[model samples]
Target: MSDRAETSERTTMAPRASELGDFLRARRAALRPEDVGLTPYGERRRVPGLRREELCLLAGVSVTHYTRLEQGRGTRVSREVLTAIARALRLDEDEISHLMDLAAPARRPAQPRPEHAGDSARQLINAMAQVPALILDRRNDVLAWNGLGHALLGGHLDPGDPDLPAHRPNLTRMLFLEEHMRDLYGEHWPEEATLAVASLRLTAGRNPDDRRLAELVGRLAVQSGEFAERWARHPVRTCTSGTKRMDHPVVGRLELAFETLQIPKSPGQRLIAYSAAPGSPSERALRDLLPQGRPDAEERPRAVLSAVASRG
Candidate 1:
């Protein structure tokens, strides 16, 4: 089978309602009336979480207005209103950004595609030498990867295919669809997968009109019941740096620190680098494997040109 495999049909579902409403509804359901210091006189509640009236009151908005907003009636909304609701919901910086994105007056425009991983970014990854690095677009599609990255995450697949958009390896997709990726996380698979979904939720909210992104979502939702269930939860989070626990079949267990660096030249692209702490056992293991991967490709550190041009 070819690497970077995709479903043959590549189906897309009918677009759901403005995600603004869905987001509000989901978040609202995740809290309880008492959680926000409200009492219902011990009366049985009809719905989960706080009632719409309760939330509106807490958000300092009228019942009718809040109801309308949740019903997808906003052609435009004030930042003040959004801020108020975000405060009432106790949203974090990442969640607040997602809220604002969902509640924006209108989507600016669809991103035709994200920028390529330029030469500088590729060289940066190469220069890191010991670091396993991969550049990914906003949609979580791998744009470029150094040899260590390819070996660390996807040794069984073709490393070059991700440089080409038509067959790019979407990290989230691989986590769910490819058995190898799921196994790599071992005991941490659930946490890793949840983070991926949550991060994607924030990205989707921010770029609702990106057609390719929407297609990816629809495809994942259709193919993986696990993905569909998680996506419906509407989890949101922003993560720049984190630690990962991975079990490589060849390298054994690895505890690595990862940093996600945004590419300034490519608005929607980010270069993620992974390394174990210096002098640590994980670092030694990484060193042992760094030279083990296939680095036979002549263009080892070449830039990832735009997806259209890079494809075979």
Candidate 2:
């Protein structure tokens, strides 16, 4: 906790740059001449990948214009230009989305008060009795969660982290900072970590006016080198549905599929649910954690008897 004192002192803000430059630079370096159908002819290359001139030529933009873009000098880049560049760079959907995000102009609107989960949202999560469900806000703060969610994901952590805005648990923060949480992904930790950071990048771009989020980024960058490195990658992805490989200490290994449902009425909130296929061993293990028919003798802290979805 004392470590946060260092980051809390500065007024460093987010959108530190459209990150357009960093993303462009990294992507450019990742590509090779042969990969792009360009002949290098063993010219004793001094640069990492394609030169700024080469990429500009391939992207069909003037070298000067593309150089300015890579230097973070362009305040506003045209969509047509971005599209051409994306095509030239062979960017996938996610990478293209990220490129757009990084090139987006900055906004400094008034920061609104921390929004809490509505009564309906709270009730909705509780209603998902057998499934582990959680409500997250724009900043990836855990606003509310069902009992199963608490047992399934947060058994070793404090339940109150979802309640108070000041004490709320940021999903990206925990993925890197907490050991137990990091272990949840087991062998697939790299994918999980990358997706978590990329999804967070998307969220951060959309909520640039949120001061607490800005501070969260600063804090993470200062406290965890892993988070800092991932943040710099400028990865972008919308992780709506995915399969998770989790190893719970009690239930052994569980492979579950998860989905994210956006709340229409809520502008920046989503309900995430995790479940295993019916009749599978994973499903049976998950069911064992729920309390529909489980006896008291078999119940423990991991057994969620009812939805105590109250925020601490």
Which candidate number has the best TM-score? 1
Candidate 1, 170-272: lDDT as tens digits: 8999998988988899889999888998998888877777888877887787778778777878899998899999999889899999999889888989999
Residue 90 lDDT in candidate 2: 81
**Residue pairs whose backbone atoms clash in candidate 2:** none
Model 2 alpha-carbon drift over 4 Å, by segment:
1-18, 291-312
Instruction: List ranges where model 1 is wrong by over 4 Å.
Output: 1-17, 108-115, 293-312
lDDT of 2 by residue, 55-131 (tens): 88788998888888777677778999999888878898888877776677776656677766776887777778888
- Note the clash tally of each candidate: 0, 0
How do the predictions measure up, each by TM-score? 0.89, 0.85
Pairs with steric clashes in candidate 1? none
Q: List the lowest-lDDT window of 10 residues for candidate 1.
A: 2-11
